[model samples]
Target: MLLGRDNMKFSNKIVVAVIVGLMSFSGVVVAEDINTEAIGNAIGNITSEIETAKEIQSEPLDKVRINWETIPGAVSYRLVIQNGESTSKDAEVKHFNRIPNNGYELDTANMFKAKDYYWRVCPLDYDGNVMGPYSAPKPLIGEEVNPKAPLATTEFEKMAYSPLYPVFSWIPVDGSGGYEIRVSRENKFSPGRYEVVREMTTKNNVYYEEGGYTWPGHYMWQVRSQNKVGEPNTEWSEPKYFDVEQHVRVAALGDSITHGGGVCNVPPGYAMYSWEYYSQVPIKNLGCSGDSVQVMAQRFDRDVMPFSPGMLIIMGGVNNFRAGEDGWDTIAAMEQILAECQYHNVIPVFVTATPINPGLMSKVPTIEPAAWNWKEQQQLLNQWIKNQPYHVDVTPALTDANGNLKAELTTDGLHPDHLGKKIIGETISNYLLTTFPSYNLTEK
Candidate 1:
């Protein structure tokens, strides 16, 4: 016996009170006028409906996707989802001990049911210990929005110095065979509005534009996922804007250290981790991660020619040394880079290679161990760098007496964290101000 639709309009408590009042009134009149059994059934149906409404209101979402803010100095994160009556750390339905990024998509098809679910995340250190307390449990309430195209993850700086070779990266879509990227002076993205458009198919998640934009102006770029047959799978991502300027006062060119990023999970695309971000002076970052001295030399023509900066800060050879390349070979490559700078009338400022800690490197799975003779090779290269015409030695500030990178300054041993990058930037900033007093005159 269910309550009629019209009866549901009344509050359950009010309806029950009204029924009790009617029964008392009926005792004073003809009791045969009202059916006692029908009244009892109506009361039972109303009670059941009230309980069902509470359940529906309490657990509204059928599926959920979780996202959280990135914690500084966190190497990874711990995510836990529990489904139970209370928000306790019990009845764990799913637990991820380590998540590299700030987001996770739960398997709704198999994992979620008509139950109340709560989720929380905690920042973790390299050793997997919790760096901070778990976030307050958040109600997991909505279906994950799955886009057809890959999601763009690169965070572009608002302004960049001339010779812009921006790195574009994205989270790969589950079924995407490849991706397409477009850059334009206009955001409309019409046929002729594109300034630089290239469709590339690569399994890797990043792309470095070799033919970079030279002119200083505003630019817009977007990316989309594609299938193996070259058909578009997703709509183009929302356009991201960045500005490029000509006639920059200074610029840093090197490998991952100069390219920026640390703490394992963050990528060089983030400006906060770059030394340039902390410097008092304005310096364009032309650094690329995973680049050796040889690769830097090879790309010099394509990367540096467009901007043709007034001054170029050269820092490299760590990649070569860590891979066991000979010291002289690395030195020779640096010389080649310097010779090119001199020919173009660009002031070449050499930044000495910082040392590495094998112990720290071993802890990060993505970072390979330093070669047996890496220290010897690094010393040789640094010594040569010091002899260059204009140089900044950040080694002394970053390394210990044993010539190893200070553990406090780095998370992965190879790349310096924010604090270490601050030291490097300040050191270089002080040097530039003293050596070239007019260096930052053109800074805007």
Candidate 2:
């Protein structure tokens, strides 16, 4: 009996020892897990703090200034800017990378041109590996205007016409009691040829009609402010230039792409409507961004007919395709627009629809991917355009072997860059050169 009890006691002792060992092992594992979790949380907090955005101050054409809290260990900050939403670091503007200063001024002392620019700043360690996260990119917009002049907003730089009645307007200047507008046949503001047709009050900024001008005449106009409480005449706004022609002017009509949206590479500024870039003919830009075929048809009379275009260069249908409208509807709109131009003795020049990059388009949150049927619709529309007598196939010049746009030619998936614009201009210019020899042509 004694022996049996001793055996039982020894067995109990062994069982307790085994249970204690297992508990100790679990305790060690729990401690290790707690330590790992704490470390991960600490790292996450540090990253978040590092990524905080800095305050940004920007003035038009003056400077792009940034201020941020100094990081404890950061030796410097790297700054990068690209043409609006370009996504590629390769597009970063020159002399703008990893600048030693926390504050940066772009373009030396010269003004930044009008453009949509994206900028970011990130801290760097001594080794230059990017420390923490980059500031969420912020967008900056620059506008094109003479800061000192009585700014003329529209119809200042392009070909102007009457019957539609070209309107001359300027923003009201402060302390100016009245304004004087002088129009001249020549650029030199000689007294004999210069006519002061109207003196306007501070209340009015527009010239309804400056009479006595012949058609097809080049004209220069200037405005001078009469200050209410200062010197009699301030410096004249840089002479704004325009041309009045009786004959039908050539006009390029399409959507925003034609309107010169997103077509910038050189300086930071708004893209001139592509027509403005085309020197081959006196082509006015009638392209409104984001317009579908139907919308364009509605505005044809208001925008195109008034200019009395000798030839209306048309490129559209992408917006319609993306909008999920019937392909036939787009064709019908084009047919109607063309017919109107024909009725008025305006020749119709149809350029095939530029290809869209759905892969690239899908990545842009603002742009919706085309439906599966979008390509088919585009193909049909393009084929139909090719069948036309005056069709200019810009597709071949702008597209790649895989049917994507030549990457260099476009800033976004849809809009042409400088190279793309050059390609389009060359194709159209060549077409017009061969097809219409009688028209006056200029190449730049």
Candidate 3:
């Protein structure tokens, strides 16, 4: 039977009748005889499916869909839509700043009066300033169409250390009911040329593989959208390439700063915001966003032991200090991390915590202001860091005369932007090149 919107109410009534009949068959229905748990579960499943169908049917259709390729190093984008052939500022009908993704869907019912329109996009830095030339203006066609394939957003190629447990992610399609991801060992994708490693469908735009790759080798992945009826709505996206290496020379472990990304909206997956992206030498990113010193110490074996690198760069405690954690407690957690590294035969390298800017922090509502004594706590931590066997001081370059993070280098004030990240990367890179020249070989 076709279970569609028209028949859903009728179907629900029938289901209710059946349930009543089953219960009424016996004067007093026993839980054991009716299998109440199974019936309840079945009803729940049906309700969930019905709700999903309703959601898909209620989604609004876009009047026009605009898509662009992701630009490297861009924290966000500025999208301009004009009324005529000219994409100039004077002819602009609409302009959007800090668009976090490569695509946008516009509802032109009331917005577009002209038959022809043009749109262009320019990548932006954390401060909303244009970072590159605008994309060639493309005609914006106003028409209803099927959902388009999602754009893969992960920068797998730039990752210094491919996680044993990898997360595949992509931009969400405007009208998609769900997504399907396919991974293969070969790039060709054809039946004979490619060996399919894994294929799965999900309602989410991101998927985490708990059981990661068993063997290290080259891998390629792509994603596509599905319609409400579970049919393919769009073709597969351009495949992203990445390698699963068996080992690495260096790895970095810490919080969001070590993980990369900034400017509030952008994530570490963008690569350009990653310090590892700017590093001359390859350093695996073991950084996790929102991680505290205690959490880092807790997850060290699970997250860090897989790659088994010769050196592990540790930079954390910002989250701790900002949240008002005690300096000695934070240091104790760091000491645990250092001890674990020693046990694993990995050289522990310390990176001084970068200062925070409260003025900018207040600007982004999502970011909490640092503790009143965060600077004092940071000084305590940095002093301990300086006393470590191997350390890299990034504070000097990022701090101002008053010891606050330089205003120009960050957007959110907590996470540094590309320029600041570049400084940190290059500083660590130079330190690695000078101190451990043997591990400085170019990553394949």
Candidate 4:
């Protein structure tokens, strides 16, 4: 049966034409048949989304390079680098290239200031037709690595009792090769006053365990970082002050929420009030943001016990809950911390985890949907806390009827604001006065 050209499938027509041509050339010198399998495989080799370096590679501007894997069937590649922070793509397009290789070495001509950039690659065929899909956008210096000293967090103006070696810690700097920590008795960093010089290869956030800080003396410490590329060390960080007080009346230890947050609409978002505002006794704020119960337990000796506080208020657990831990896990960690306090004769006071709201939870981009389960664990932990002999319940005064944070008391659902801080401070103050009758708490 004769088939009309329009009626025949395209692939069938190609096969019929090829067979007819072979038959006609049977008696003549004809080349071998075209390999359809090879053609199909070649087309299949054009893979989309070429693998590339981390959106932000930890390198300085001059050392940065745009790198990607070579794609099959790709004769060339077109690259685009744009300012990630720009409002329009054209305004920030710093470099555009149709290069022959899988990577591009950047020079000052296409370089930008210390800022974030976006980059992508599109595979091209021999004639410049795009072969496969453009890669997903990647950041060039998505986040700039910290080029200098990490800020020292613990032991800042803190006084540790003698015989207790305090741990020192700082915020981790991205892309740092290591850190050099220096401690000196005199603030001037003179020749003889320096006590310790240690280089840390571990992540900077963890406390340095080598102790030797003595009591009834003033000490200062600073930190600087080695560049990731083996470059010279960054400038020394500003000094932080610490004193070795023989006796500590009180200390507040918890996660970042305890460090004082929800200070938005106010400046310096983390802390709104200091230790002096919360307690009438000589106390220190030993809170670090994002610390889980396990983290607190690990640092108990260096962060909490060194103060030799007569009363220690423990408020934490939300981070653990958010990380998928339940009430029992949190309680176990709490028991360990409480036991440590007991061993040292330091009184322990338990503070309930603050509340969270569904409305406010979504505002934080990094917080996942699983965070919704945080409240249930928090409630269970808070209830268990209240059952303890000595505890302060912030949940009752801090929550709304629906188990969410009271709107007026918090700037974010997690951390309290002025109103909530007042409630907690007053509650702790009352507990301290009633628990320890002889201690004088006049402001110094």
The candidate that achieves the highest lDDT relative to the unseen native structure: 3
Q: Arrange candidates, best TM-score first.
A: 1, 3, 2, 4
Off by over 4 Å in 4: 1-183, 187-217, 221-240, 244-246, 261-276, 441-444
Model 1 lDDT at residue 395: 90
- Greater lDDT among 1 and 2 belongs to 1
CA lDDT, every model vs. true structure = 0.76, 0.61, 0.79, 0.62
Residue-level lDDT of model 2, residues 1-444, one tens digit each, is 455878866765565455456655877543323443454466567667666522132333443434444342344578777666665767666434444333443442353532466677787643467777777666644322224546553434433222222345565554467777666664244533544443434345555442323344566666767766534455777776666555455777787666553422111112232434644655565666677988778878766765576788898998988667778889999898888888888888999888777766665567777766776788888988998889999888778887777766654466666567767777887888888887755521
Off by over 4 Å in 2: 1-247, 263-276
Which pairs clash inside model 1? none
Local lDDT at 423 for model 1: 90
Global local distance difference test of model 4: 0.62
Backbone clashes in model 4, listed as residue pairs: 157-241, 256-289, 260-270
TM-score of 1: 0.74
Ranking by lDDT: 3, 1, 4, 2
Regions of candidate 3 where Cα sits further than 4 Å from its true position: 1-76, 87-90, 93-98, 105-116, 122-136, 140-147, 163-169, 177-217, 226-236, 438-444
- Model 4, range 119-146, lDDT digits (tens) per residue? 7888865446777987777776542233
Q: Model 2 clash pairs?
A: 113-268, 114-269, 114-270, 216-245, 256-289
For model 3, how does the per-residue alpha-carbon lDDT over 1-444 read when each residue is reduced to its tens digit? 677886876776666667767777766664345554566678999889999989975644445667687676576899888877775578998888988776676666565353477788999986788999998777775333334556778876766666444567776776788988898885444533657789999997767654455366678888998998888888998888777667777888888888776766656666777888888888877787778999889978777777778888999999988888889999999999999988989999999999999888988878888899899899999999999989999999999998899988888889898889999999998887888766544653
Give the residue spans of candidate 1 off by over 4 A: 1-63, 84-87, 110-116, 142-151, 158-165, 171-180, 185-196, 204-217, 225-233, 362-369
